[model samples]
Target: MTQGFSPTSTRRGTLAGIAAGAATLAMPRIARAQSEIIRIGFPTPLTGPFAAEAKDQVKSAELAVKQINDKGGVAGRKVELLVRDDKLNAGEAATRTLELIEKDKVHAIVGALSSAVQLAVNEVTRARGVIYVSISQSDTINEVKDFSRFTFHEALNPHMTTAAVAKHTFKKGSKIAYLVADYAYGHEMLRGFKRAQEALGATSVGEILHPFGAADYSTFMPRLRSMRPDILCICNFGRDQANAIKQAVDFGMNRQARIVVPVLLHNQRLAIGPEAFDGVVGGANYYWGLEDTIPSAKAFNDAFKAAHDGAYPTDYGAYGYTGVYSLLLAMQKAGGTETDKVIAALEELKYDVAKGPQHYRKCDHQSVQSVLVLESKKKGEMKNPADLFKVLATEPASEDILRTCKELGFPA
Candidate 1:
């Protein structure tokens, strides 16, 4: 990986309080006629490796609902978000979705961060016929085994995210090695990057997957040193990623190869510091600095800061906000919350989000929006703590990259 490859990097308790409060919520769950509220289920990993980003997502969704309700709600019905903690487990995600749908009577659901959790949630929501709108980047969330007409994704899939950054990587160097986790999302991430490297006439040096939550990457680094690939395409998550990047920095691995962290977030920058992540390229869903490109993006950052003690927006929050915001617009357009009507409206829904104009590609229900390819600014280049990434380009989604349901062997 070249230093200029592309786009693109959690907490714990006090965590539970944030989760519980967001569940009951600040978006007015105030007393109203039962029929006056439109319920959307939000299931997320609130207490694991995924906590920091997932909470940002769920709270931002709450903020969107508050904004919608403040403007007289979706379709004149106040939106009520029903929250559940999936605990980063697939079985837990399934049970949470079931409870949200069958017991809480929510009309739709937004899934958790983990692909395995998302697969479970998709299974439940599809069989039960509740609307599922996701920002989960894993391609298989809507794969043939689990896809349903009721589901729509607002974020780029793993393939799209990887390719967005990979195109830029091809311009930098060849002979790539992958450092990934060992799960569904990781497998998809590896597969996507592999295809990109091969397509760009690059040769893969090797691939290594560290178990989730591995405290030390002591073993992986020396092997990366030995392989001597020009690029290190990382597909690990949470603390695992932070640990890997930190160790790489300490070991001066960047002298050996460039780093590419697919799906970087703001919190990661804070956790590991700029020196550690220096010269890395990342594929990301949103960046706070996008406020410069998209006017309303500034509005979101301003509001998010005011609400959270001057905190900044992450890609997770950006996608979650856009997803909920568009869902509300689709409902309003449909004139009712009836499933078929809303689905029809969403298939053509166009809304200006933090990332300019966004519309759903009907065949696969994936949002056709921009994915940011960014390079991490060096410690000296940083204007402040929040100014982590210097935007390379906000690449537009192309039909060539986003595979359709039919191509993925899903029912049309």
Candidate 2:
């Protein structure tokens, strides 16, 4: 399991108090006067393996709501966020999602870090016509045809990340081995990378699946080392990802092989440190250093740094911030909280986020946005620790990838 955020006990308690107090004060009014307030549900893993990411999401969501409310939130209504912790489990996520939709009566929901949780929650939200904005990378969330009435996604899917990594990081005929988590999201990432690798004329040497939250990776490292593939693709997140990379380094695998991570985040960089990350290639939805390329990105980075004492924005934070803002935009565009209208607006979205201009491709509802292919540079090559990555190439939007989703029985 990923480690939970280690905020001081007092601080954690205080934040919980604030959230509870705010919810208590806001819910009654929201229920009585629907036009006066818009309630948004945030169902995320706030206490489990992915807790660090969830903590960041909470902060980002709070910041977004505060900003929106300060500006006289959507359609002259104040925005209220109701948060639930899913413990990063699929069943738990589904239960919490029902509570938020049926009990709390949220107009929309934004969260669930893992694709598995998102998929489970989608089952509930879609059936009831509640708008859901997924931040996870699993392609299945947006590909399901029956859920179009309520589901939309704002993050790049595994296929987008895998295709970018395959095109920019691998050499022709390169031998590859995969160390992936045994979960829906990890499996999707592996499938995407496998297709991309084969398309690039690369050979799949072998694969090892690690159960999520496996503490020690000693058993898996030796098999991967034995394969001696030119590249090792990782498809796990949070502490599991850090542990795998660290264990691989301890087993001297880094000295012999290059790593190709399908999803890399700033928190992972902090966990693994620069020495272990050097020369690694991976894909990210957004990186702070890319701020120079987009002006809105610079403003977001500056605001986040100021608020969090220079904390680097991770994929979780970006998703949380963008998800709330995106939903608000959709609500404004739709003129009200009508589920179908909000979802249609979201599907047709073409906005400039912290990353460049992004469009939610109508076919799969996947964000056709920039996915950064980064090489972890050494300290000597950096102007600062945060300058750890050098952009390689931005993969062009491919209709073929979207077509593949439809071919695989997903909604076109």
Candidate 3:
């Protein structure tokens, strides 16, 4: 999101004069006198249900910061990371973001895994003219009215991921049912899936929205079984996601209907386990196995595995790592910490990160990247326990997907 502002100079003349005189005197020693620190604020759910996911993000960010600083830092400035927990709440996210910007005075901020937290933090950061790069997978984060000059989304939106999965799993005339969480993220994911399904001439046979963190999906499962669609799309996250898939299996819906997950992260995959997810089709921005094809990705995966005892890095980790580095690259291009310049640089960016070719679309500030459509293979078919997927297809990029995003109230 981008924002506009009027430039103002409020420095008192005498103070300005003194400062200028001091700067003149210190010109030769400016490099030594100036603080070499560039602080980055990370606001995420360090506690609560999302703790495991958040921990991966924190680890990834820490690794990235360490790598950057080791490579002579960014333009001779040592990077400093300040982490704050949002506790998975938007209100707390906003409060913590303000603290980071005003009290901590961070140069830029990377944020929480939940879209709600990202949206809340973006609002606060935009209003205050601070740079915020979102690592969350919420399309709404990029739909701000004025396109806040400081905000950028480094993660792939639901539109891209959903469309990719739908295209891979749904054939013409395919019947589908959606079991979505009753929240902004779930709604957005459903919208993306519905759009893609409709474009392929598929029918949405049924739809159900349950509250987040709901324990029992028994009611929803029967509804799904009754519909008996060719495919059942699950657009929930964390425990809700795990429960929905598990119930689908327990209710025998899995035997009748193929399961499709619009956005399944690593933790959720582990939560549901392979037994429940076997033969499932899902979408992801990056998978650790893809690292072999790309050097940077290979390095990242190796380092991440080394640090975490071979645990696979999830979307949260990949996004957090790449998101922070991307923002740092933009800051470098902008030549300073100024918000507008940084946003402009971000919009113009195109780089091959771990996820493959990724560009921050100038029109909507949405990251354009290749999305993987993966099918869950049985445990026996796996080369290793972590190598559980078979690549189905790489979705073709189209302007139409992004064009539809505009109708969804996002900026063109």
Candidate 4:
């Protein structure tokens, strides 16, 4: 949502090429062995409704590569970040991922914007035994059926995020309704919301499933109003979230029930503005405002700003950086890019990057990290244009917030 960098086609294609080529070509056999090109595949929706978020993701990932290359890269090997536009379609995502791995020979993968798209891309990565650091949210990805030894989830799953949100926002006997996108992401969020509802003794009024990128919420608005829920949870992302919130406000629903988003995006808040987004509560993986109190946040924020004309990174955009940077660190720790060695290294990795200290859970490869409970700021509360969220609480990274390994169908 903030002013961020977008790569031109020419620049995108040539990224890290010269450095990697020179580093490898100039070396003798012994020297060149450690200087081989390490290509990282990045697949995200760059042409659809999620374009804005994808652009941010690309910029942040590029920043990670730039920072790493500046330090001479992993064990003298330069990284060539090969990005592809998945167009937000599962089939297209799979196709692009295959090309990256088979054609481009990328050693690993780091980006996916949507739940379904991530799942599709995961299939390709998993089949090839390539390490995938998913930046998208999905509970199913952590489950045994979809998870593999090489799979690492850098983003918070639906259960972990929603449970924290419910603890903070839900009251005993509260009536809730859901406006879910009709897909894997929405279904997963709905499942988590229901679990939260049961845990908190909150009652569900009704649920309405809408298309992922639906432009109109008119039909669903009237039915939602009839439900008369005390809290309305809109489980969607990107422009869908912005449009739904705007339409809800126009329908005077905001006056009746509190609105909660499962994932609050900085760009979405900017699109909806403070007026429509005001008083909304949601969970965030990272917020640039944390730079004030967190040293790592300050580092990431300063570097991003220095590169992109003083623009702060978006919450989702932080995932892109964390995913790539963490993977590269793991490769460095492993001393090479062998799949098994890298996997072992990632499991043992403890990183403090865009956020606080975090590591992947061995059982499911889910990143153990904090979830910030953020409330949208009112227009009167704005200190600056970018000051949109007021952090209410920081839910510390704990196994308690996450689904247990046993719950994810993992054996003891």
Q: Measured by TM-score, how close is model 2 to the native structure?
A: 0.88
lDDT of 3 by residue, 147-214 (tens): 55577778778888898888888899999999998988899899989888889999999999999879
Between candidates 1 and 4, name the one with more favorable lDDT.
4
Local distance difference test, per candidate? 0.78, 0.77, 0.77, 0.87
Flag regions of model 4 displaced more than 4 Å.
1-32
Clashing pairs in 4: none
* Cα TM-score per model: 0.89, 0.88, 0.88, 0.92
On residues 8-34, what C-alpha lDDT tens digit does candidate 1 reach at each position?
Answer: 101112322333333443243334353
Alpha carbon RMSD to native, model 1: 8.9
Cα lDDT of model 2 by residue, 1-412, tens digit: 0011122345333433433444445444333454657889898998967888888888877777887788778888899999899999877887787678657878888899998788777666654456788887877665543334467777778887898888887788899989999998789999999888888899889989999988799999889989989888888988888888878888888887788899776777776788888788888877788787788788778878878889767667888888888888878888778766887888777677567677666765666677778888887888876777888876654455453665646544
Ranking by TM-score: 4, 1, 3, 2
Model 3 spans with C-alpha error above 4 angstroms = 1-34, 144-146, 396-401, 404-412
Instruction: Quote the lDDT for 286 in model 2.
Output: 77
lDDT of 1: 0.78
